[model samples]
Target: MGLAEQRKTLGYSQEKMAELLGVDRTTVGRWESGKTSPQPCQRLALASTLKISLQDLEALLAPSQAVERGAGRPKASDHPSSGDPDEMIRREFLRILTVSGALTVLPLDEAEALADGVYRGNPADFARMNSHLWQVYQLARTKGTVYPVVRDQLATLREALSGARRGNSFPLLNAAADLFQLAGEVAFDANRYSNAAASYALAASVSKEAGAYDLWACALVRHAYVDISEQRYREAVEVLRAAERVAVRGDSALSTRHWVASVLAEALAGVGDLAGCEEALARAEEVQDLPEGSSNGGWLRFDGTRLAEERGARYVQLGRFDLAEEALKKALDQSSLAIGHSYRRRGAVLADLAVIGARHQDPDQVVTYAREALGLARASSSGYIIRRLRSLGDEFGPLSRNHRIAELGAEIAALRAS
Candidate 1:
């Protein structure tokens, strides 16, 4: 049975259990929620109070994924029985558990060091893995393909966070911030904006605690994307402005401040603030001089390579089809615009060109570009690409009677986003 079931089976409320165990009621609650495991001393008392052996208690503490309900015991008992040798071995096992348990509850560097001896991967490995995952995320056909990795990464990071000592917490905090941002990106890509917002907020809080200015700014900028994706242009502008202010306090070498400006450009264009958009784009250009190979390349991956696409998309919003066409075609020519590979980015450009076609009162060009984009969208299974095609479809209302346009509209409608 689950820990909560065991507690109730023994007729012990969390409050009473906490009092008997000399811990907080919330600690008991966390134990029940799988957020924490008890210390060895607490385990001894808990096993006695719940009338279970240590082996059964260990099974109860196993992570949900590591457990099997029906197959609870070993097929055959292999333990040595009632010998002095076996007793000595059990003593050593309990001793190691005691030290590990003490370390789990202690909030000091020495305790953390002792726990590190248990050989879980270090914080640097975590940061490096998260970076690679972000590259994979960008290159993945469907963004949701990255979630299982993100989820596992978050679980590992949570274990580290719960065991962190204050003196040794800077790396853990920074890692948490980076991982939380990655989690937010996965959630954002999946269109789970509420979960995305919460993850971004946690990242910002942890980054601030670590004095990680760039990480903090990135989180706030992501929070702004939640606003922008919902069409809250004015709110997004406010968020991006706040992020920019935070970015000013970040390292110039890292391009955090400039990246904020890049997002601000999109929000400004969304609101039809042409002058503001131009200024923001100009500010984002400063990233060219900052540095290279510095981005975390996972959550903080703003190198300004997509400026052409951003500029074209902004121009599309501004109704400057001539400028949009020139910029978007150039964007489509870059190596980043491969058909099936960079479908999300490439499809977006095609959709913009199709919009430009619609703007010019050319139904044939609209159907032509839109059809290619729809094909890429289907191949990629990208929700963002599908959304872009749907947006372009809105402009085809005037030409609804045109056979090809109507057919293209129906094709876009039939996309199942598998």
Candidate 2:
């Protein structure tokens, strides 16, 4: 579940949610964007609010499939009750969980030390810190509950970035950009769109200074998301166009430029410009022709199929039912596994399909897509998904008495009220 869905299901406004969750509004914004996850307590609270089991909430909090580790044989430790276990093994497992739980609430200095212990090398440290920051950002979306911790960490990271700049360290510059982007992500989760945009813009600039084209493109894409969310389609297109230009000069063309173009298509379609959307989509299609080894698997990891989902979303926006159905079907069939890891993404696809149904005045279609989307929205804790569901409900204004549509609307209303 996305943070936005959780907020909606719980009937929390971004600011109120932040206050209740003990976080700044910006932190909530980050969680919605998949830039972060909630801490254990926050997750419990979120689950309680959404009326989901803690186990289901944990499933939502798990890392996206994109970041899942490689498949390997199970360890002996995997069988907790195995007869081969030493007498002291269970105690150690409990101890580890206890320590890990305590560490989750540690202050910045201690957390940094633990991070250093967990990731000894510079590159490993970068990855580890980035991952933790992502998790923190996610948890921050629960509202006020996690704001103080994230705020302190961002302050520390900012200071570190400044120090690196003074030392003329390139890796530090890269790290600073990454950290700033993470901070921005947290801000976004809390619905602080302007702050999120500013931070991402700064990250893009710093990445450029570090000569990290992939990072720069990523920051720009994130910024575009902010614009898109605000329905500033023209502004979103302009930002994406800039990203496209920057991406062309980068090492990861297949992913970078393709993603930019795909987003541009969605933005254009949102503005009701079909021709522009089609043009951008065609460029995205061209991205599929890139060679297999073109992706570096860093930031710009597009392999063409990401655009498929965008195409479906754009067609939905354009009110092209046949085209939307075709694109959405293809998107569902070929989307990356990570897309399914977040209930929010799945709900978004369903929401798009619901819109298609609503446009055609098909009550059955609306019920089928909207109800499942509402369920997913509740599971994910995403305000944005609920907002989208509201849009779908609006589509029923002309057919309010339609029993199926009204039932779907009532179900969504109840979810939002929870």
Candidate 3:
């Protein structure tokens, strides 16, 4: 039987299943009707709730023969094979999570060895998988969806590390470092600052042990970001300075140093050091000279593409509304920001522009930008965007008394509550 038949056999109404899965009832309906498949993050829970193996769940969700024939859809075999490397990595990741519970009941040594043998998981495989997960995390509207898989991967990494021989340990340590940074990102996006801080600390520690200078510096930069987000500019500057020193020892071909500089500029601006902020921003702009592939795209995505927005944000922080608006408008015109490719970035830019409006006492401009930002926050379900909107709402000050601005604040408040 298909998903619908299976659901009925299990006596689960669509609403009941939706409630259990923490998804909308319509989402469940679409899954059963084959209009959509469960996301990677939803697959584990869906499989557990439906009392089926993940493989079986995939079968149920597969396009039916009749539908395939009617719609001229490609046959299953004609599609990417399950044996594809990426597919194998994903399946292996889920399998590890599924059996992790049972592993905990076994003797520590035996469990570690068993986990090691299960996949004989190569460091390269883990690295590739970690990269894939980062992409998934970036694209997912609900960043929290990545937590389960990331947790499972961390558990697996711990197991591998526990039983690893001395010769193989370094690579595994590198992988662990990379994964921890991702975990920190997921936590940071959720506004779990403490968790993010802890994760970044672990990442930096492991990266240092692995002698991966770039990774180590990147972790420090991320750790510093938590401080910047909390408005601890002095603390952030200390961390960023350490990161800067570490990055100097890393591959100059990479943009690690430049990325650190960019973030340092933000911290400087927060502390009202306009000259220092400008100097750091100029240093960051040197990233434009780096060759292609300067970034690994997973942990270090900074490529000069964000300079305009970053400059604008720093200007906003320093109360330079004229410079801020000019830079922010340029950033807004970028294809990714313009087309809403990254809701977080676009929302942040919009919020910054709204703040400029508040500074100018222009209620119309504030409402225009704030409204668009709020809509993006709601659509993306991004805590990062919500945080930006919250900051924008605070900027309204006396303008919050304005009818349109007050209404906008109310909607933002409601969104935060939800």
Return the top candidate by TM-score: 3
Q: Model 3 off-target regions past 4 Å?
A: 1-40, 43-118, 336-340
**Candidate 3 lDDT tens digits, 88-175:** 2344344333333322334445433443443465676667667766766766677777776687677767777888998889989998
- Tens-place lDDT digits, model 2, residues 1-418: 5556766877888888777767788777766654444543356666776678878766665543122222232232221111212211222222222323433555546554544432222434544455554444443323323333334434444544454545555676676677677767656655678888998988899899888887788789889989888889899988888888788788753567777777888899989999999998998788768888555433444566566667888888888878888877676665445532345556777888888888888877788878888876766567667767877877887767887777788887876676
Best by lDDT: 3
Considering summed lDDT, which 10 consecutive residues are worst modelled in model 3? 74-83
Return the number of clashes found in candidate 3: 0
Candidate 1 local lDDT, residue 220: 92
Which of the predicted structures, 1 or 2, would earn the higher lDDT when compared with the native?
A: 1
Ten consecutive residues with minimal summed lDDT in candidate 1?
A: 74-83
Tens digit per residue, CA lDDT, model 1, 280-380:
99998877887676565677777888788989999998888878999998998883544433677788998999999887878988987888898888766
lDDT of each: 0.73, 0.65, 0.81
C-alpha-based local distance difference test score of model 1? 0.73
State the number of backbone clashes in model 1.
Answer: 0
Each model's total of backbone clashes: 0, 35, 0
lDDT of 3: 0.81
